[model samples]
Structures are given as structure tokens and as C-alpha cells.
Target: MAAVAPARRRKRRSVPIGRMLLLGFFLVFVLWPLYWMFNTSIKPSDDYLTVPPVWFPTEPTLVHYKAALFAYRGLDGLINSLIISLSATVLSALLGTLMAYSLARYNTGGQHLSFWVLSQRFLPPIGIVLPVFLIYRGVGLYDTHIGLIIAYTVFT
Candidate 1:
């Protein structure tokens, strides 16, 4: 009984405080870029690129949001982003569910297929930019919203 008690306690010790703290730190680190982007959008560009970098804008303004939403084709970019994100979400969900069902019923690892799909995600935007630029240029879609949508769809 004593030996069994120690084994159970030992299993519970697998996740220690250090691991928890490290995980919390990693989450904060990973999310910091997103937080910074939102923060920048709320702040004036001058304050955004300041020395020491402000953690929180003292005078948070909606000027950037207004500019992005209502000024100079920014709204068009937002709409394009929404369309791309929604399309990718729908496609990925449908494909993932179908693939998962097939794998579950067939008892296949399907790991290589999943790995290849995941590898597509690892590709940086820069990797395909030149090819896309050339293609869009050839097609006379240099600055068109449809071109941007097609480019995003292809990458996804």
C-alpha cells in the first residue's frame, strides 16, 4: 500500500511548478506580438516606434482604427482579409473532418498526409511573393482585390 501511494504521488509530480511557470511564460511570449500589433494600431505611429517601446499607450486613440476602417483603401484590405480567413476556415474544417473520419474508420495513421498539410502552413508569405507578383503582373491584377483573394486562396 505504501509503495502504491508513492507511485500515485510520483505520477502527479510529472507536471511541476517550473513547468507551469514556463508554459505561462511561453504563452505570454507567443501572444506578445499580437498584443503589440493591436497596441500599435491604437497608438500614433510616432509613439509606436519610440525608444524603450511603450508597454501600454498612455493616450490610446482610435485614430488608427478609423484610418484603417474608413480611409485610403484600408477598408478594402480588411474585407480581403476577412474573405481569405473565412474561406480558409471553411475549407480546413470540412477537409479536416472528412480526413479524420476516414482515418478513424480505416485505422490509418494518415500522418504523412497531415504532415504535408501542416508543412504548407509553415511556408512564409515571402517564399511565394515573387512568383505571385509575377503571376499577378502577367494577369494584369497588380493591385486588384480579386488578385489578393486568389493569391491567399492559393497559398491556403
Candidate 2:
């Protein structure tokens, strides 16, 4: 036996003026700040603050980046943040994988657990920060990189 397919009508293609205008407006709106930030960032110190405002950086330099990590003593803080972030990311990936497997294959915790996890996301971080801060301090986890990593893992 053979089957016949039904005939289909082609879609009419036309760009609406309103949508095009909206797209153009959003493009400029989003990109203008990014363009201005880069334009200002590359300017030399002398040109960074000029009488007439040198918009194009006559003598561009990478000093701003150097100053951020060196002059402001941010290198240690940056390294600590990186360690915490990476640890949290790795732990989250492992736990998330196991949780997903259990939920999909074994239906662990049932729908109630899933609902509870989903609901936790709706609660603002500010609500829990105070209690968490006190508990972490008492347990000697406060101000340590491990504390930060554990906190990051829990948030997600």
C-alpha cells in the first residue's frame, strides 16, 4: 500500500517595519555602553582625564588592568576567588550529575523533593545570608576559601 501526502501552502515572507525598527533600537541601546567602556578604558592616564575629554585615547595603555591586580592589592583576593569558584563549579557538576541520575533512573525523593529544590530558588539570598554567616563563623568556616566554595555550591 502507498500513501499520498497532503499538499502544503508556502509561507509568505515579509519583514515588518516595526520589528526592524525595534531590533535596530535595541542593538544601539545594548552596544553603546560596551563601546563607551572600551573607548574610555584604553585611554592613557594623561588623556584619561583631559580638559576637553580625549574620547579616543591618544596614547593607549594597559595600565588600568595592571593597577587593578597590583596597585590595588587584588592579586591575592583574585586568586582566592578563583580557587573557591573552581572548587564550587567542580563539586556542583558532580553532585548535579548524581542527582539527575537518581531522579531520572531511581525517582529518588519523589516529586516532593523536586518541588522543594525548585522552591528554594525563589527565596532571595538575602533571607538566608544572615543565618548562614553566623553558622559559618561559629564552625570556623568563615573568611576561608572553603566556606566560599561550599556556599557557592549550595546556592545553585
Candidate 3:
């Protein structure tokens, strides 16, 4: 008599328990800090610096956000920050794109250019901050949005 053939087993489509645990831990690590920041931002001034701190606000409030956006002290600073940040971002993208095109198309050897760009990142910001501050003072552009844009462009 012929023997019957056994059926083939399909592979299981599941992650290993170890991987799942690692992923869960990583997600909690990343998200918990952000959640804490938002939580603190929404908490009342009285509860902000308490011992152990509150994970979730007992009486959630929008006062901090409202003050940040609409109040006299907050709104002015926010506007100034937004203007400077947006200006810098736009300028950097434009300049970097042009620089990238030049670097890509030109047959300048890779190592030197790479070193040049990498070197910029190593220079301590504190070392140059004072000279920049002095220049801005001389130009009468200190504390101004345009001055900030110029400074950021030069540094980046």
C-alpha cells in the first residue's frame, strides 16, 4: 500500500515577542516626553512645578496656549520668532539647493568638499557668538528680524 503525503505547514506571520517588546518600549520612550511637554503646557501655573509633577492635568486649561498666542507679552515674542524662523528656513533651502547643484554638477573631488561642509558643524557656536553680536551692534541691526535672518544665513 502507498503511504499518504503530509500537508505542508504555512509560515507564521508574527513578529518575535522580543521585537514587539522593544518596539513598545521605544514608542513609549519617544512619545512620553512629548506628551509630558504638552501636558505641562496645558497645566495651570500653580501645578506646573509641583513635586513628582502631574502626568495629566486634573483640571485641564487652555490658558497657556491662549496667553502664548494672544496676550501682549507672549504674542509679540511669538510673532518675532515666527518671522525669523520662517525667513531662515526659506533662505537656507534656497541657498542649499543652489550650493547642492553646484557641488553635484562640478567634478570637484568628493573628499575636500565633504570635509569643508562637515567642518562647519564642528565649530562651537559660543566661539563666534560674540563677534556676531558685535557686528550686529555696529550695524544697528541688533534685536531686529532682518539681522537674525542675515546671521542665520551666514552661519548655516
Candidate 4:
């Protein structure tokens, strides 16, 4: 029998060291701020304003968290945010479904009407802010939960 020829090995391509170094530098630059924020939160107040920044806290404390949730009423604000967001989401979904169904089944207002309605979404919030604020104020809904829910639902 004839001797089999030796099998050839494939050469694997290697990544450039310079490109890897550049990507690593960008990764650190983007993540450094997030790391600093977390580090600062856990650090003692005295270490916050030190000339040389504290990379690691010797004694981590939860006093800031406790103060935010209790003393500053952060818990109440969180609850209010949840309520407003949920209410607005539900209302918007319900109204949008009804409108879409009507448009599809009945072709309410003609073919262009759907386009007109969708165009409203592209309008900048800044343009309507003053008008909505004025209307809310005039209707005595300013600073109320219901008003915020309505505003969010409409904008969304």
C-alpha cells in the first residue's frame, strides 16, 4: 500500500494587539463613570471631597440609601412614579387599540386619516409642552396624579 501524504495544518489568524488595546481603552472609558458612581455611593461622606479620589471605600455604609428612602421621602416619590406610569400605559394601550380597530374595520375618516394620526407621534414634545401646561393649569389639574397620567398617555 502507498504511504499516505502528511495532512496539512491550517494557520489560525490572530487579532492585532493595537486594535485590542484601543477597544480595551474605550471599554474602560465608558465604564469608569458607572464604577465611580457606585464607589462614591458606598464611600463615607468624608471621602467624597478628598483631593485624591478614593478608588475603594475602607468602610462602606448604607446611610445615604436610608436617608434617601426615609428622610427625603424617596419612597413616596417612587410609589407615585409607579402609579403614574402604570395608569398611563394601561390607558394608552386601551385607547390605541380601540382607535386602531376602528380605523381598520370602518376606515374611519379615509385613508389619509391614519397617516395624519401617526404623524402626531413625530411632533416634538417641546412644541406642545407650553400648550398642555396651560390647559392643565386652566382646568385645575396641575400637579395632580390624574393630570400626569393623562399627559403621559396623550404624549405616548
Predicted model with the maximum TM-score? 4
Better of 1 and 2 by TM-score: 2
After TM-score superposition, the amount by which residue 29's alpha carbon in candidate 3 deviates from its true location, in angstroms, is 4.3
Clashing pairs in 3: none
Residue range 3-116, candidate 4, lDDT tens digits: 999999999989999999999999999999999988899899999999888789999999999999999999999999999999999999999999989998995797899999
lDDT of 4 at 58: 97
Model 2 misplaced regions, further than 4 Å: 1-26, 107-111
lDDT by residue (36-100, candidate 2, tens digit) is 78888778766756688776776788888889889998897898878988899999999999887
Residue runs of model 1 more than 4 Å from their true location after superposition? 1-14, 80-156
Pick the winner on TM-score between candidates 2 and 3: 2
What TM-score should be assigned to candidate 2? 0.71
Ranking by TM-score: 4, 2, 3, 1
Clashing pairs in 4: none
Residue range 1-156, candidate 3, lDDT tens digits: 999899989998998999999999999999998998999988989898899888778999998888777875887887888899889999999988988887878957665995798688899888999998999899899988899998887777
Model 4, residue 126: C-alpha shift (Å) = 3.5
Better of 2 and 4 by lDDT: 4
Which residue runs does candidate 3 get wrong by more than 4 Å? Answer: 1-10, 40-59, 100-123
**What are the TM-scores, per candidate, against the unseen true structure?**
0.44, 0.71, 0.61, 0.80
Residue 12 of model 2 has an lDDT of 92
